[model samples]
Target chain A: MIEVEQLSKVYGSTAAIQEVTFAVEPGEILGFLGPNGAGKTTTMRILTGYLPATSGTAKIAGFDVHENSMAVRQRIGYLPETPPLYPDMTVEGFLHFVARIKGVVAGDRAKQVENALTRCNLLEKRQVLIRKLSKGFKQRVGIAQAIVHDPPVIILDEPTVGLDPRQIIDVRNLIKSLAGDHTIILSTHILPEVSMTCSRVAIINRGRVVATNTPEQLMAELAGETGYELEVEGDIALAQARLAALPGVKTVEPIVDSVEGSGEPSRQKLRLSLVTGTDPGREIAAVVVNSGLGLYEMRRTRVSLEKVFLELTTEEKAIDPETMAAAYERASHRDTEPPILPISVTTDQTTDWAPDRTQSIKSDETPIEDETEASITAEQPSRPEEEP
Target chain B: MQSVQILFANLMAIYRRELQSYFASPFAYVIAGVFWLLSGFFFVAILLGPEGLIAQANFRDQLGMTNPPIDVAAQFVSFFLGTLSSLALFILPVLSMGLYAEERKRGTLELLATSPLTNWIVALGKLLGALTFFVTLLLPMLIYQTIALSAANPPAPFTGLLLGHLGLILLAAAVLSLGMFVSSLTDSTILAAILTFALVLFLWVVDLVGNSLVGPVGAGLKHISLIRNYTNFAQGVFDSSSLVVFLSYVMLGLFLTAQSIEAFRFQRS
Candidate 1:
């Protein structure tokens, strides 16, 4: 339903979105996740034909954004970060207006507006001035306007922003319900919304798509090398050395295990992150048994999307927000170290919060590389992004 | 057929909303009332004051002023129209506080930009909507002349009256469009209003300053003189060339409005 090919948008000397390329199929809900200021909104704007890309092409329903904007617009519905609503107009009046503007005919305009209002659960707020409505209601009105004409392609930017917990749930459920009826591409700072509402996830950072796959697929791809976290009763260094010597064990790290109580004779419990190309639980148990160490707890390390995302997007040494650009100059040295590829971005964690589209797992990536890299690299992983 | 239908739909949505806003606020009535009061004072000044000047010139004297054989009422309307045209520059920025600006301020303009309607179409509809309100305010004054004539002996020259009204409205519309263009430049209403008024006032006096110059430069200034063109129309002369000038001004305002909307797309990227 949507195709963005090497789409680039630039302002003066700065590039907002560079070489952004992605595609969404019909009836698919593609969550565009990114940190704030990531080019998610810019990409959506280009696809919706709101802005022309500086380079490359974006198409909706086979119509070019720049060349066939009129046709492209007609087939697509877009809800921007700020709902384009006239506060002076009432809910009913605004939707009716949007319906007309979206090309709903005079004969059925009222019905179309009514249907949209109903779908957004805004029937009672029809007579209320948009400015008078609460933020959530105003958002509902925004959604009403987008879907009033019932366009096949829907592009929503941060649909759940500024909502309280309940409202967030309500909007999320509403988005999920919209599946199959519309091809939805939504950009948001919220992570769980993608896992819950989007069928496929595209993580974008710094204007590039860094990852894309189903939520489950992403979790599995991130956890490609099966391994376990083993805590053993022995000297931390001894446990680490023992785990590192096991055959088929790709790598091992003695992660610091903090215990609340002290002054006891209890031996240190070393948190071991062991890399095995296959199931290594039995082999690890044999190693611990022969090493005369008491096996504390041994369990598989489950990698969640949260870990994958943070691991994928963190910039190791970000320029201090203080010195601004000057600090960025110093931050460049820290930019190169991370647990993942794009090894040189130690200082550019700026896009970690924004969906780094470039983080999408390559279908052709070697499984061996995925495991050995993430396991050994997690020891010196970059700090997780600060929540907004 | 579908796209055209969509364009028409969007235009009318903006049109109705704009027209409704004009009537909903006191802006139209307030501007017209103040203008009418000011025009009445100017009319009284030119007709009935200063007998010395009239006697010296062998002209008529009514109240305290000397008067040329100028249709004093038309001259009064013309002078007020000039000032009122300038008023549009002020009133419009406040009135057009929404077009693109409010949408931007509220983030709705992005939705509009992304909507099915083209940017130019949205802009033109909005421009026409604001000007329509301006025209509505002028209509009451147009009717005022009819009542004034009902009490007179020789009736008002119908053609000259129309020509004056047309010129007055076109000038006001042009001023409003220019103001709307300025309004589109920023999300700040106060800034738009102030800038628009400044530009209108500046352009209004551009001709006067230009004409007073020593030589050939003054001739060029006359071409840009907003007041000069209106003066000819107020005297009941309809010059197609001057009409073109005002038309060009309106077009220029619309073009700028369109460009500003498009520029946002780039900045956003």
Candidate 2:
């Protein structure tokens, strides 16, 4: 129901959103996931016809948001970050006013306003002045005003912002209930909101869309490459060398490097992140046994959605040539010395907290060549595989 | 025809909301109360005070010096309207200051801007709403003026009274329209009111500056002075040119307001 193509908004010298392209299918709730200042609000505003895009076009129900703004506006509902409410007016009065301007017929205006108030659980507060309502109620009134006309497309910018936990859940549920009939796009910095509420997620960072997919698919794509953690006694270097030699093993590093000077030099905790679809569990155990290492504990773990989000948003994928060469030298030199884990290697017991796994995996990558060459030669393997 | 109906419906919705807000606000009532107190005081003072028009006229009658045929009722109507218009000069700015600024302040401008209703439609609705409220402010004064004029020996001509009040309304509409434009330029109602006051004050007295100068430039300034045009109607002169100037101010204010809002859509901030 909505198509945004190469949309960009340049403010003086800074670009608020650059080449932002995303689409929401009919009846689908597309969660616009991004960190603060990630151009999510800018994109939402452009799509809602509230602000004119510097370039490109947004269309709702086949009408360009800029060229046919009135038609697009008639078809869409928008709730800005601050709920556009008249504080002096009652809840029902505000909704009726919204319905009128949104082009609801006079005969149906009261019914539609009532319908919105009921949907938002605001029936009890209909006669209450808006300024007298609580923050959550005001937010509900904001939502009611947006949906009063029963528009097909709804764009909300951080709709659940300032609400308490219960109110947030209520608003989220309200938004979810709105999904089947209205094509909904909600922008938020909250990660769990997207995973719980949106059917498909579009993760934007630094004015660019880094990835877009269903939440399950995004986590599954990152979790596809399984990781293993092990505690071993006896020559740690030898066991790591053997594991790194395995075809599918991607990186091998000491999990607890802070314990290096504290004792247990002979005993170490190590983690191995493998290439996609390659477990190598049996071979890994065999390698450790043959290397005369006492294998204490072996546990398999999967990447969570939080890790996928952090990887896509926070990882500095584009390494400068100097940092790359320095990282390459460090990687090659580490082969000779005892494996002190790179700072990027998260020391968490499981991969659940490994937000910087991409950096750590790249630094400890085997053969040294893939470490430097793969970054510049092709797309980073750690990048989230997004739909075209 | 259907489009016109929709437009009217939308306009009424906006207008009714604006009017309702004013009726609900204590601040608007305070403004009205102060206006009534001040205007009521001046109404009685102008008619019955020691140096008032009636006292001076009666004294003139005692002296038997009716040379210019002074019509006391006409004189009182014009003088009272002049005072009311001056009172309006202060009060109208406060009234119009919140027309768009308050919307911007409360963030409801986003709702109006994104809606299917056009910019000019919203501006016109707000103007009509504010103008209607201004009319209500005059209703009490209208009653007193009618009673006071009923005692005239040669009852005040209805046309002259209508024309004089019409002049006051036009002057008010002109001021409120311009104030609305100024209000749209800022989110701070205080700043909007101050700026509008500064603007209207200049237009009110431009003729003083115009009198000192000579040639077409001077004539042009005097011709455009709001008070000068208003005085023509207050004195019961139906000048089409003055009507055009008043209408132009109203149209100009509305047009400029629409343009200001349109430009706001593209503003980076």
Candidate 3:
């Protein structure tokens, strides 16, 4: 439902976003991840029709942002990084004004306002001036304004920015509850926000999208050597040698045995960690049992989204200010190359060890036409499988 | 129809907010209270005191100056009315400072900008709200003027009376419109108020400075002076040129206010 093609924005010496292209299909939540000043706000501003892209164009639900801004605005509800508010006005007064300007029907406006206030848990504060509210409450009021119109596409810029942890969870849960009915472009640099809420994650750095995939796919693709941390009772040297000798066992190392939690005084458990080119967990288990070594427990540890995001973005972080600005401008407008790289992870001789049942291969089969609506909270009756 | 609807909607919003602010704060009460008290003192001084207008044998002494008098009644009243025009030079900026300045400062202006309404609707709405508040000060003064005119020995110049009040209303509208336009240029109400006062006061005195000139250059300057245009109305002559001039000023200020808001759309992008 949204297509951004080679959108780029250039300010005299800096590019806010660079040649960034990404799409959102109906009923999908796309996480817009980036560091501070990484063109996340700039990109959202362009999509929300708040700013003109220096060069490229973005379309919302097939309506060109620049060419048909009013139409695009009508279809999108944007909660800017700062919740635009009038401190002097009461919550009810402010929402009433917003409803009028947003073109809510005269008869429906009261109902919409009441519903919005209730949804944000602001019904009682409706008569209280916004200035008297705490920061978290003000933020909720901001979210209330954006969603009061109930536009299909909701673009929230750092909705959780200043809220306390509990309030963050409150807003996060609110976003999740709305996800099924509204396509959301959740822009935030907070890594866990994406993993927890968004179905697809796009990592943007220095104004360009460096990578994007489901949280799980990103972890699986970037992963290199699989390792099993095992605790066993045996002669340490002999077990290590035996595990190394097994097929597909690339290397073996001893991990320090920290038994503080086990409370077994003077009892030692030998730890064997291995980088394996094969299904060494099963093979090594057989070898160890055959050798009469006690195998207590074994498990694989995977890299988290935080680790993957930092690694991919840091490599491209050395760009000059001029290039960085240009890239941000370009990325915001998506004016250069499509930042979309096919997340093609081919399971080669790797498929022989398919017991990692949590693995689901990502299909790059997503077409560009359906990006915007795909992430909405509304159910996509036409789409059979909305997941990537 | 679209423009009309937008204008009415924005006007209603701004008017309600501005009116609420006026009553909630002390600015309106202060402006009106101070003005009436001052005007009241001037009124009592003229008709009741020893060297009052009652004993002058004509309204000439009501002018309130001695030997080759400066017509201080008209002068003091003009100063009183000048205070009306001058208070406009001051109070208007404060009233208008919130028009677009607060909206932009708070970032709520985006809600208006993205709406289907054009900039002029919002501009006119704000202009009208401030003008409505301004009228409160002028209306009472007009009532006093009517009382003074009726109590006169031979009766006051009806033409001058009507013209003078009309001139005052237009001046308030013009000043408030200019102030609102200036407010739209920035997000800081303090800056908007300061700049607006400086600009309006300058325009008011431009005519005074021009009138002081004795040569051909002065004559040319007086024609463009804002005070000179209002002087004719004070004396009771309804000159079309002056009326047209005031209307043009009002329109020009509104036009620029609209343009100022329009410029934000580009700058913000």
Each candidate: how many clashes?
43, 0, 61
Report the Cα lDDT for residue A39, model 1.
84
Instruction: Give the winner by DockQ.
Output: 2
Give the TM-score (vs. native) of candidate 3: 0.73
Highest lDDT scorer: 2
- Tens-place lDDT per residue, model 3, B1-269, is 97567557766765676666566566568867876686677666655556664556355656655677443335434544554555556677777777778888888777677654557766776777677777776777778766766665444456666667788777777777888888889889899889988887787777667778889777766765677788777766678888887888788988998887776766663
The best candidate in terms of TM-score = 2
Write the candidate numbers in order of decreasing DockQ.
2, 1, 3
TM-score of each model, paired residue for residue: 0.78, 0.84, 0.73
Give native contacts recovered, as a fraction, per prediction: 0.82, 0.93, 0.45
lDDT tens digits, residues A1-388, model 1? Answer: 8888888888889888778778899999999977666689888888887778899988888999899987888888889888887767889988887777777778898888888888899988899988799999988888888888989998889997777657777777787888898999998754456667789987766676766778666555554633455556656566668777776565565433334213334544333333424555677778777778776656554223343343333232332233333222223333333323222212122322222222333233332344334334444423222210
Looking at chain B only, the TM-scores across the models are 0.81, 0.98, 0.80
Per-residue lDDT of B47-94 in model 1, one digit per residue for the tens?
344642223333444443443344545554555555555555556556
TM-score of model 2 vs. true structure: 0.84
Alpha-carbon runs more than 4 Å astray in model 1: A12-14, A220-241, A245-248, A254-305, A308-388, B1-9, B25-76, B79-83, B86-93, B96-98, B214-216
Candidate 1 local distance difference test against the native: 0.67
Model 3 lDDT tens row, A267-358: 23333333423455668678767877766656553222222332223223322345334333333343234444322221111211112221
